[model samples]
Target: MLLLATVLLLVEAATAVSPTVRLQYASYEGTALANGVTQWLGLRFAAPPLGNLRFAAPQDPTPEYGVQQADEHGKICLSTAGGPPSNSSDEDCLFLDVYAPSNATRNSKLPVYFFIQGGGFNSNSNPNYNGSGLIMASDYNMIVVNFNYRVGPYGFLASEEVSKGGSINNGLKDQRKASQWVQKYISQFGGDPRHVTMGGASAGAQSVTLHVTAYGGRNDHLFSAVASESQSFPPLRNVSESQFSYNGLAIRAGCASSSDTLACLRNLSATDLQAVNINQPFPGAQQPPLYMYGPTLDYDFISDYTYRAYAQGKFIKVPAIYGDDTNEGTVFAPKNTSSYAESDTFLQNNFPDLTLAQLGKINELYPVEDTPSFPDSSRFWRQVSDVYGEIRYICPGIFVSQQYAKSNIPNWNYRWNVVDPEAAAEGTGVAHTVEVNAIWGPSNVNGNAPASYDPDGVNYPIVPLVQSYWTSFIRSYNPNTYRQRGAPTWEEFSGRNYNRRLMFQTNETEMEGIGRGQQGRCAYLVGIALGLKQ
Candidate 1:
């Protein structure tokens, strides 16, 4: 009788820790954590994009047999730079992870938060995100989902032949496939597809905005709301304009002499192809664009430039939260710049279509000025940073927010200003991606929070505060519904609100308005957005 009792206890513990969910494809057994969160990691949503499928849209995963253990993460997609080393990355990396309350059942129908990882559209950093913290922050009320997508040349390669083969913007298509997978299988995991909120940071944010205007604003009910942090709007070049890049890559890959370059590229070994997949300067440009390959003007999927799409009211009418960091350009700006001529050259290279007169006006608007906040950088560096910030990130976000307001869409805007002491000391105050730890909580940042985030435990409160607002927005669409106590109500960014935005800071969160000078600068840039190809 004693031996039988011990056996029964062990079986019960195994059943509790390994929870299984049956999907149309197969049964997946996920691990249940002590914090009441259950996670199914490295589950394949689409088939491996190999051989002919390279640079093509993702397809549904093949049916699997028996139960698969989803305890480990899948290999990340290959990247040109700043990603996992080549040995750790692969071409067959189209898996996703789902996190939900341990007690959640099929009938629970909880809200879902589908997050996209950002890495400048050239790398996949999905491994950095852990959804368990987000589930715990929601008090086990909602589910969180994140996934991996193809990046670099494997995803964004483009040319006339590639376009003819229907392979443009494969990276964006991978994101769509992930979202569609959620809509199809999330209900089986106790999530409501109707209440899904899509959120992303940086390039992921740009992907959200692009989906908002995808196929000329066709709403497929993929997501009901959006949360975009530090949205980026780089210039959208046409397929013909990208042919040079394709030619260059072909030459480097030893396929230059092939009669059918596209077929040759598709047949090359993944290792050989990856060797030549790297960023290169555009034609006649001194420096390369921050991102080598991005979404192109594929008349079918992308349709038009993002600015024109928003201007013409070609976007889904969804409640959204749009925001950016205080110094968005400091990280992307040219550091060696020291004079107005260098700044002008940088702008000209970035926007080669801009006329000299327009460049002069831009320089006049942002003259060389001392920024005490950045004492280490030269005055010209500050000027170029300011210009790049407005043109690339800040102004684009505000333009989208303004369009939403004009259409009476409920939306909230913000400027993240949380200071990191080390970054401040390095003269990059509140640089890009600093708010990620705050949103995901210190516990989820690879097991421990950086000293900059929880210094002496003084800045710990802001983590919960930031998580509360985000999870609240995920659950109820309105951030104030479940905001932390003493946290001020976040107002909508409407015309009557004077284009006000919440300033997210440590112990000083408040609302502020867009100044007239900044507004004028944005207006000038928006007027010439087409010429700049943005």
Candidate 2:
């Protein structure tokens, strides 16, 4: 059957013409790889959100006159001037890329896997979602979709003046458009839109959960399953509360007096908007100012706070797979704090409405770990990392899974314990995002360098298992059914094992069931989150 499917796909690839249209698109043969992989790169699913359309919801593209060359990648969205992936930062960067088996045919009906790139919605680009590795790793068993969306201020700047119709979470709206695009056009690429699953890590993972909660749980039939690596129900501000950032941004952009702040800001150059640095790479030194641009509770797209929506059982009913790193907080944990008081001050200052009582509870939950690897780690820093991990990431994942498990939601959960040996030497085990290269395969292009680096080769013994489980879920919305490489049987999450998680470690450590160790520590966070919603 596989051989027959291969012949059919090769024949179709040889004679393919684009039948799909967001508005009359045409297909072109993409780069044929040495390993026989093929791609249709830089495909535009929506019209460029430039000028008058800036900050507005995405609109479908205007039909083209002829087949657009999809051999090259699209420009990445505007990012910090020196940040990675590309120097081709522009407002007209809303594009997506598709990858498939060399033999995949339009009639193949292969499962479509839509992946969103994560960078805290501040940095990173579509280039970060290198799908070639996934194809190479999965042997082209599925079609992969990767896309670029507005990031930072260009995507998430919010204010009441702009909130009238400018849309608070335009970045997320762009995400929705990308998913919708797949449902409509993926068939031409040998993809089954009905079998689509969405996946993300870090900010991308947050986006998936947001989709799960968008508009009180409307599925929109975009994705039937979701794989969230490092998913979090991040603390976000309501539209009214976001007025502080909006007021400051408008003033900084010299649009303070404009009756239509959105219009005035839209007319400004992308350079002008990018000039105001709203986010920090870490929590100290030059990291003055609190907060960064993120999704806002507009009472429309994101009607309620995320945790509140989940606790009330108001999210999409799809089965979900989510997990966090064993040392997830180490990467984002605040640095340079000298005393416990500094940590307390920073937390109270950064997070809005954080009460002293909560702060006290947090202090009690985590103490300084002064192990040789974590030598002299401040009580403040450790405590902050603990709270951040719990409230920001850990609890959200477990609590959501448990909620679903109780209702028989069949959500799968895990924790990543395998860190690169290099990071392990520093005591920061498996920091956030180390698993991405294992799954997507890092981009081969490195600015005038050869595609020489291969993380999979270094990660050989374990890479296949992780990649298989992910693709398995994408294909069948279940991982156990496609268990590969003698990988262990991953159990569906249930109330029977409430806080239990599949511990994903190396061969020596072994994948096994590990009790959620922080249930008691996390309860305080869950309570605080619930209280805020009420």
Candidate 3:
């Protein structure tokens, strides 16, 4: 009789209550992401960025209790003006999403991988990052973390206007405080506080480098490993607003530039604040737009140049995995073409210091002559793939690794040469966000299908191999050196050897050896980057 009554009660409860459960977190909690993975979403790590909180260092999220629900993503820091669709945003948006194994309990202490999303430092979030395969497939229990922070002028506006303490890189401070929060509270969610690996792609990967280098010593005991995919190191160029002595939007909004205080700028609406970074006439300058709306040398967040910071050994010495794809420029290009003419007019306008002879030599060294011809359909794509890849990614990325490697740091490199042959025919090779989609499953890239699936519903088999190597690095700080049953041996980048880079592909998994000088114009560009006479 008792069993029957209990069954009846269970049925009644199932029908009466919502399928999801609500719980309050450290602060500003919510009900989002109650999918297959056990989720704790929108828990604040820092204080709301309203009024007084503006420009100040992040404040700890005061623990609060109440039956709060977290069944979906909360909000993003509203898009920078007329950028993209930014639904909900608030000063209280410094919240993180924690995804753990459904079977994981409070007692299961697992390694943690904190992902910093990439949007050229203007905006991003990890809630959109799917950990289904990385978590379930690895079987080695782990905690996945993603969060959101301020973007645009609200994030990286630096000037004398900050003297009143209402200026600087608030976005970077948000990340720092978020990391601190993870160190403090992740254990409750079954994460090993000490085994954290900070990882990201593009700008986020740059952030990992900056965090370790600029904000070193702060969390020496916290993060042990880092993986930076397409991470651009500092000394980045082409930030229109940043180059000027004052904030670009401030002047545009009729604020007096003569004033050296952030009072007027801080009072603007978040919408208006974001307008400063909107549709920034796509970076035509020498440098890639890694942080057009990102952290600057705020006395606290960034004290010096990021490259200098790393070179001085001021960064946390953590094992790192950093590399980029073969063609990352397709992410952004204006009618792609594989060639760029170094006109005398352009040289005079952009690099006035260079003589005609110098400019010619520069072009010759970083040659754009006699290149591969692309089909009419793929012409534009090839240009974007070549020029942009050289300037924006390949050169900078390799420079970063070589710089760190010179310092004897434990750094592993890979070139994601995997391209979908069909996609290549469509003019998009192993494109910019291809690896990202493959690693984390799918994103809203093509609309109908998930990010990883091709037209024929083919799933890339390389996904597991890449994920396994990544997770292994996250777990033991060692990328899987184990040769597959019939695969070739993966090698480390030793100076004794010229150039050895692993190619993570779809079917043909292998590593190739080549000459660093002959492979590409990386060494020549490095000289230009270091300011040595060509």
Best by TM-score: 1
Worst window of 10 by summed lDDT in candidate 1? 9-18
Positional deviation of residue 41's Cα in model 2 after best superposition, in angstroms: 1.4
The lDDT leader among the candidates is 1
- For model 1, residues 427-502, the per-residue Cα lDDT tens digits are 6667776677789877676754547566356566778888899999999999999999999888999978857999
lDDT of each: 0.84, 0.71, 0.60
Worst 10 residues of 3 by lDDT: 15-24
Better of 1 and 2 by lDDT: 1
Residue range 383-446, candidate 2, lDDT tens digits:
5666676677777888778878867887898887765665665556566656666566445323
Q: Please write out the lDDT profile of model 3 over residues 286-329, one tens digit for every residue.
A: 43232345566544555555655665667777788777787776
lDDT of 3 at 465: 67
What C-alpha RMSD separates each model from the true structure?
4.8, 4.9, 6.6
Task: Estimate candidate 3's alpha-carbon lDDT, on a 0 to 1 scale.
Answer: 0.60
